[model samples]
Target: MVSAGLYWLLSLAFLWGGFVQMGYPGMAGEVCIAFVICLFLLRFILVKRFVAASVFNVAATVVFFIFIAILQAKGMTGVA
Candidate 1:
């Protein structure tokens, strides 16, 4: 119930962010996909341990930065 709401909200956020990061198509798409993957991974490992949450956070952050790297590689400083 509550998680479903959260997922929709997060999906909206990711869509908006991904649109802004469109300069690097591959990286932006990968990061958005990673966000969704983390959401499911966390759900699959809920409550038994906090490890899944921690890993998701770290992976999401890394993916975001990787997207930035791709943007730079594409020479799209003004895109965002």
Candidate 2:
């Protein structure tokens, strides 16, 4: 139950951060993507898939960053 709350909070944080970063020009997607991948690996190895919350957090982070990247690539800097 606590883990689930943490996941939701982290997911929202990531979404907020992604949009904030999106406003700035020349933000590299590679770094964020790498971080997300690492988080996934860590969650899988350490958490052992027993906690579904972590997975949702990671997935939400990844998806939000991807969306930001797509928007940035399309020159939507001001949209954020």
Candidate 3:
């Protein structure tokens, strides 16, 4: 499904950006926001299941945000 593909793409982009942001904190917030927003939009517009999609989206957002936040706050400058 398109929604599934978009979810995967958005998630991968978020993680990759977070990884890149290890050395560039300047882009971390933007990357996190973009990923989160796009992920939600994809779900809201394309997904039909209420509870299942909601849970999946929420989990992904929280995990991605935490991942980016930790990497940025720790001042990591390279992939770990």
The lDDT, on a scale of 0 to 1, for candidate 3 is 0.61
lDDT of each residue in 1-80, candidate 1, tens digit only: 44445445666666676667765645655566566666566657763465555555555555545755775787643434
User: What's the candidate order when arranged by decreasing TM-score?
Assistant: 1, 3, 2
**Candidate achieving the largest TM-score:** 1
Q: Which digits, one per residue and each the tens of the lDDT, describe model 3 over residues 1-80?
A: 44545556767776566666656536554556566667667667655655577556556666655765786687642433
The superposed Cα distance between candidate 3 and the true structure at residue 39, in angstroms, equals 8.0
What is candidate 2's lDDT per residue for 1-80, written digit by digit as tens? 55556555654555455556654566543334454556656666656456565565665555656765875787744533
Collision count of model 3: 0
Backbone clash count for every predicted candidate, in the order shown: 0, 0, 0
Candidate 2: 10-residue stretch with minimal lDDT: 27-36
By lDDT, is 1 or 3 better?
3
- Candidate 2 at 31: error in angstroms? 24
